[model samples]
Target: MEISTRRLKLLAILGYFLTGITGGVIIYGSEKMIVATKTPILIFMVWSGLVLVIVSLIGIYGVIKINFGYTVLSSFALVVVSITLINHLMYAIIKDRSEVESDRKVLKLWNRHMLMGRAMHKIQDRLDCCGIYGFQDYILNDKQVPVSCVSEELVSYIYKQLGCKEASLREYLFSRNFIIFSEFTSLLLNMITAVAGFKLCSRIDRGI
Candidate 1:
């Protein structure tokens, strides 16, 4: 395809602008949400989103080239952030439900994971897992569950109930969490990639 030099510059500039804007919005929203909510999860989102926004900004100047390094880090960032987000997001939205049957079903496995994880922890307070930096010593059962080692039995039951035909307990626990988040994160990922692809396509459209 024949290309024009000026259009290529425009495409690159547009990529820089769009990513920068998205990153900015996420960063600002995260900061606001952090202050507004005392909940552990919201605090976690602020922290995660802060990091993600930073990475996204890296794309602004040089996402296309190998030297950018943004592409390398983004994959790891998205996967980790997505899992944490899904579990907590689900918990937050489900809080109002009166343990109703449909609602309970949606929540049961996730709740069990947290409960059994807490029981396994069996500690007062030290490290906050997946929430925020530094451990807050106050325990809230009505407070959030502490980070802990989950029991094997709890893992197995969750796996079986979730329709696992194969019975590897390890597969159920760690992998299941990934499976739960993979779908939601894919949506976010598509949004990101779509924006990126658009920037690239725009170059072609303009004869860049």
Candidate 2:
């Protein structure tokens, strides 16, 4: 069986629509991460994601309505957002690559944002980790490691483990990479549908 051009165009449009929705959800959903960390970098990332999400929704609406002008504008916006997402993701990956540096960064964030410190303590209790790099992080910062780092098995005993920086960094990088991948995929999907829309609009212009 062969698919008609119209059918293919419809399929592409649906794909783009779904991709936009997915990207929007991911981008908007990152608010939780931002609240947990409350770092300037995170604020910027979430802001970018929010912008991408809004643009994606615009594209989705335009494609669904088959509006040539709206589709053209939204596709252009998507291209710019995709490039920005990729660039920020790359910069974050590089900045977060080192555990020691990540720990230092986290400490600075915690100092500037008291809420971040509380969140870090909560994370330590849940993950059974110490400070960012270890107990030494607390010492260097002139703060004592929270009791949350103590093992349940030996509450009375002080047990020190690897700092939460490694795990936090790992989770952060994974989220960044996921966003990057999603944005890249969304870009391709938008391109495909945008091209189809352009061709369709051209045909209408030619009265074919």
Candidate 3:
């Protein structure tokens, strides 16, 4: 019984550590990516991390105190984490699909006038890309190719060869895919942790 209790405590501690690391990674990754501010997936991921961190803390405390109630609470928290992850995953997929479809319309708006033109220029500068499709887009639109399209070395041969649309899409897709992968991985881990938490609760309830 003593050995079982010791193992349970250790498992709780491990859960706390793993959840902490996972939460930190997700938050950090979101910050580093160029995703839109306060995006749904981003907000959901932040909240998910916070909730998991709290859940892990509860698990640790419950194990330390051998409290059946706290143990059960933590298990419920893990269930919450699982549900949120699944919700966010589905939302992210739908959002990605919709965004891809709307990219052209968004780009057209961005190319409409001087104000949006400046915004597009900033994107071009940041991504080191040219117009929608290439430098030829500027010619087609009767606009001058901005300096943002040029490389630092001003290599004439490759000038304005890359397109802002492609670059931005690539970055967006990469960020979305990364977040999706993280959520899926976290969901799996949460399931395992929840199972372990339930087992631990049973042992504590039996006065093991």
Question: What's the residue-level lDDT of 201 in candidate 2?
Answer: 50
Off by over 4 Å in 2: 1-5, 35-45, 89-101, 109-128, 135-145, 150-160
lDDT of each: 0.40, 0.61, 0.72
| lDDT string, candidate 3, 33-67, tens digits | 53332255666677777777778788778877888
lDDT of 1 by residue, 30-91 (tens): 45433322234435544655654564555433435533245434434544555665666576
Candidates ranked, most accurate by lDDT first: 3, 2, 1
The residue ranges of model 1 lying beyond 4 angstroms of the native Cα positions read 1-20, 33-36, 96-208
The residue pairs in collision within model 3 are none
How high is each candidate's TM-score? 0.36, 0.66, 0.78
Candidate 2 structure quality by residue, lDDT tens digits, 1-208: 7555577457646755665575666556566655443345556656665665565566556656666666667656656665676676677666655455456656664565344456466666544667766767777876666677666785555755667777567656655665556656656665666565556555434544
lDDT of 1 at 16: 44
Model 2 residue 162 CA deviation (Å) reads 3.1
Model 3 lDDT at residue 186: 82
Model with the higher TM-score, candidate 2 or 3:
3
